[model samples]
Target: MTWTIRPPRAEDHDMLAEIYLSVRRQTFVWVDPGKFHHEDFAAHTNGETILVCEHADGRLAGFLSLWPEDDFIHMLYIRPEFQGLGAGTALLQALPEWPQHKYRLKCLVNNRRAKAFYLSHGFVVTGNGASPEGDYEELSFCPV
Candidate 1:
């Protein structure tokens, strides 16, 4: 399916919130949906740059939430259904234009599938980080 990946607009908060909620409902989703109340979604959107993937009909098929690091992909996600359709790669391809070096992100050890996806994308395990919940191993990726 054809798609357009674009920076999220102010009006996209409701849609973005839906994506966030969907991920939280996923079996591997470690994030708590309660923390992303609609009232604060816009604020979170500001802290984490949002990119929405729009299908040919203009529906938001997925999104990538990037946390900049020295200007790189700190974190990201695509709707589970659209995971293998190049949406993640499209988001990664758009990051370097701002002039960044290495990108780093953490994944819950239980999310084996996601970890594999990162590995396939050229990210390597570098170290580990921990939240109150548990350990989140960090994976680093350099633009190829």
Candidate 2:
């Protein structure tokens, strides 16, 4: 399915938060499973450059939040139904500065699927760190 990737607007706030929370509930089942707060997701996305993915039918498919100045990807959440459909790649490619920026992200050690996706998209495992739930692998990708 084709998807349009674009910068987020104020009206997309609630939808973005919902997507964030939903994807979290689906992907991070090991982290406080079955619990998600939109308020917390909203706060976490504040001040980040967020881009939303819209399906051809106009439904919001996914979103990615990035801190451009820091070259970090804070979140990249695609609806469970939309996974493996290229929305994640589209969102990552939509990063403002392209290959010029050295982008980094963290994937929980238990999220093997996410780690594989990141690696397949050119991200490399750089390090690891402990978190309240467990250990997370730090990954970085230089777009070029």
Candidate 3:
């Protein structure tokens, strides 16, 4: 599928929120789904730079948000149906200075898929820590 990456507009928030809530509920089965809320998207990504991926048909496929100051990717969530279709990589590549600068993110230890995805894309585990949700590995992709 073809996808275009663009900065989000106010009108995109509702769908983005839904995508965030649903993907978290689906991916983080250990967490109580009730704890995930639509508003969490806004709260978590506030002040971050976000890039939304839209499919050729106009549906929003996924989004990636990052703290530009630290080159930290805060969140990268794609709708369940859209996973593995290149949206994640596209979003990552769309980031500012991608492949030419170091970028970092944390992935829950239990999320094998996400960890593998990042690793396959050249992210290496740089550190480890615990979050309210679970243990996580800090991963970074450093340009060679």
Candidate 2: how large is its RMSD?
A: 1.5
lDDT, candidate 2, 34-73, per-residue tens? 5578886778887988889999998888999888788889
> Compared with the true structure, what per-residue lDDT tens digits does model 3 show for residues 1-144?
789999998999999999999999999999988999989999999999999999999999999999999999999999988999999999998988889999999999999999999999999999999998999999999999
> How close to the true structure is residue 96 of candidate 3, measured as C-alpha lDDT?
80
Off by over 4 Å in 3: none
Candidate ordering by lDDT (highest first): 3, 2, 1
| Count of steric clashes across candidates, in order | 0, 0, 0
Q: Give model 2's TM-score versus the native structure.
A: 0.92
Clashing residue pairs for model 2: none
Give the candidate order by descending TM-score.
3, 2, 1
Model 2 lDDT on a 0 to 1 scale? 0.86
Compute each candidate's TM-score over C-alphas: 0.78, 0.92, 0.98
Top candidate when judged by TM-score against the true structure: 3
